[model samples]
Target: MSIVDALDRVCRRLDEIRACVRWAEAIVREGGSDAERRASNEIRAASFIAACGAMEQFFRAFVEWLCGEIGQSGLRYVEIRLSLHSIASSGDFRSLQSLRERDPMFGRRMDLLNRTVSTKSCSLKVPRDELGLGGETIRPGQVSNVWAVFGLPGSGFEDLGQEVAMRVLADSRNDYAHGRVDISTFLAHPECEPSRFLDRISALEEWCFHCWSAGLEYLDSQGYRR
Candidate 1:
């Protein structure tokens, strides 16, 4: 396949993964029998987790191929790709440097994965989900490290876990590698104030819809539909 074709495929996959994540979020929101709810949650979470794995593979491979095509050195190419993409998405060029300062291990892996995934001898190991983010199959990978950045109320990665700036950014292993927007504001939106947790789940659903739409578009462009 042409490079464009490969990119098109990857984009479509990424979109699907995003939709799956959102789907899991939505299913978990609907009130139902305990068993039913658990089943739904498991399905959604499994789908999303699979999608995230595919995305990690896509990013690693895409960056490596692009780097090889452009003749960029392998050293830290993952970081460079992420930095550029992050800049495009977040409008913060400094986030790359800032993230670097935050954790050097992830920074380095990002760099290596970007360059390694395309080589004949290289492989991008998608991280597993030990956090029970979903069901059992969300095996960990180097990207698993980003979950630390997600920061819960008290611990893991971020030292100051205030709700004021609750970070909703995507983990490197997430389907949305560019990172998600701040969930705090969306969850707290007036429409969601009554049931904050449910609202957050709704936001996740919206995220899934966005991913689905984008993926469908990409697939349509490729003369495929689902």
Candidate 2:
């Protein structure tokens, strides 16, 4: 999807979820059946879940495209190389050497990492784990870091509001997806601060929106076309 479409997808989902929450509140005030109220809450929760998935997919697609552009444009690879190399440490090198001494596979892995980070010939198709952040799955939080690693400036990614909210939303999404949390937890309690939950989610959505914009601007600045 184009950048505008991707952003619209997130915004639309948020709108659906806001309306869903309001519907649940209306049902409660009207003394609707318990099942009806629960269903509304579940729909709202489902909307949030889908929005998170869309945001994550948007990130993956953008990064994959940006990586391809970076590989082909020949604009930022030299800066990325210098930035990556300057951050490398002797201790890191020694650890790699130790891994190589125990198993040649580590040696090969080290060689490939060095080449991929320093060369423009490779696409950003490396595994999510290769980025070296986050636990288990790579949510939008990790994707934001990947932006800086390849595309240079991360724009507002490093902002404390953006970073913390993304991480929190990512973990909460995981819990919801894995069944550790349920819809009622968010909607059943008036004291639960549902608005605060939406605020954090809105923050994450805003970050994705900006990240998409930044990626497009980066490509434009590099003279890359779709």
lDDT value, candidate 2, whole model? 0.58
Which candidate wins on lDDT?
2
lDDT of 2 by residue, 1-226 (tens): 5556666776787777767766766776788897997776676566556656656666665555666566665543334444333222223444565564556656656664665345343333445534543134445446655654554455546466766666665666666678886656654443224576667667777777677767767777763311
lDDT of 1 by residue, 1-226 (tens): 3345555665576556556555545656766677865655444434434444443444344333332432322233232333222212231323444554556646655654444333332122222232233222222232233223211122222222211111222231242222452343333334323233233333433333333343334333521111
TM-scores of the models, in the given order?
Answer: 0.29, 0.65
Judge candidate 2 at residue 111 and give its lDDT.
Answer: 60
Worst 10 residues of 2 by lDDT: 82-91
Stretches > 4 Å off in candidate 1: 18-30, 70-226
For all candidates in order, the CA lDDT equals 0.36, 0.58
* Clash tally, candidates in order: 6, 0
User: lDDT at 167 for candidate 2?
Assistant: 67
